[model samples]
Target: MTVILKKVPESEKYILRNFCSLYLHELSNFTMNLDVGEDGIFHYVELDNFWTVDGLSPYFIQLGGDIIGFILLLERPFLNKSNDYGINDFFILNKYKGKGLAFQAVEKLFKEKQGQYFVIQVAENRRAIAFWKKVYNRLNIETHERQDIIDDELCLIQTFKI
Candidate 1:
């Protein structure tokens, strides 16, 4: 399978919307929550707007002319920054999961900007923690906690020093 990675352009707005919706739905299902209502979809729209703004540098992973995944790399206040690089948001469609596409996306990002540290925040729940731990451990990237909180759920920060 040929995978194409390109910066998101205005023409692909619909693909972005679909990708975000499917991704959020899958995540909500994984958390055993039916909370992804209309409001939730609207929330993703707002996030998409922010990421879609000029200079944000959103990217999409396309397969056979269809967008199957996306990775947004932008600066945010809450995340730790190293030389202005942060692994902001990365997700793939459920059908495309477990195929090592995520690892490939991250690996490519790092290779593009060599020696820049990349960090991803994982929810402090069982599934998220396990998934992140497995990836970072296999890659042998140093993991460090910046912040963690448990309100209705738990959240953990996983940092990868590249």
Candidate 2:
């Protein structure tokens, strides 16, 4: 499985939008309810800003030329703190989960975008928390975990310097 990150092109923006809906649908099972419009669009605000914003990067996680996931990275620091790159969104399709593909994709992402990294996972998403922990541990990097309240929802935040 050759996992690669390809920058999403403007012409393929719809692909990301569709994937965002899928990601949101999966997240809704662990987090708060989301109102995806009748057209099944989720994260419209962020989607709009991502296209116009300079610091935002949206990548398609491709496995041998097939897109199986998406990752959204914010070049800016988390909460405006210096040196932190925010992992705004990460999702692997259910059919591709638990195969170490996410680890490979994230490792490539970190190598390509090196900086202090911050990732937030819904407190209720035990799988996500465990996945990040395992990834950091495998890399032998020290990570700091904390609880934070974002948008009035408690979340698990993991920060690491790589």
Candidate 3:
């Protein structure tokens, strides 16, 4: 039942790549008709730059000793506000869903990286919107929400200072 966010090591780039492909595949179901590519891989050309990017971090969500998912964080200020961070990508394997594991993992992630945080869910994904609302309620933090068009798709943005 131990959930941990382990920083993805450079030596394990393949691990992250594999997980990213899976994450993208899952997201495609809820996203705006995203293509998973001919080879069924979501190629992120910028993944190699994660190590060098100043505020970007990629972490593996490890439950016990197994890698179950990943979260990509961006530590950039939002709307000129300092110390604002973004949860760019988060995913828990389909096999691991409906088990309260994501809540534990996200709670730990927020506790360790406390600051102004922003989370975005695709407007089409009702389940994700509901899940985030529950998470925020469990955390007992007040949040401001708005809808915005990002990358040609409308997204539900939640902002909270933790």
Best by TM-score: 2
In candidate 2, how many Å is residue 81 off?
4.1
lDDT of 2 by residue, 1-162 (tens): 779999998889988888998898888888665767876566645786677878788999999899999998888722376555888899999999999999999999888877788899989889998999899889887988899988767899888887
Clash count, predicted structure 2: 0
TM-score list, all predictions: 0.72, 0.92, 0.91
Model 3: per-residue Cα lDDT over 2-65, one tens digit each: 7999999889989999888887777777766577677869876678877887778889999888
The alpha-carbon deviation from the true structure for residue 27 of candidate 3, after best TM-score superposition, in angstroms, is 1.3
> Number of clashes in every candidate structure?
2, 0, 0
Worst 10 residues of 1 by lDDT: 75-84
- Which sequence of candidate numbers ranks them by TM-score, best first? 2, 3, 1
Pairs with backbone N, CA or C atoms under 3 Å apart (clashes), candidate 3: none
Q: Give all candidates' CA lDDT scores.
A: 0.63, 0.85, 0.85
Better of 1 and 3 by TM-score: 3
Q: Which stretches of candidate 1 lie over 4 Å from their true place?
A: 30-34, 39-43, 51-55, 76-83, 115-125, 150-153
Q: How far off is model 2, as Cα RMSD?
A: 1.7
Better of 1 and 3 by lDDT: 3
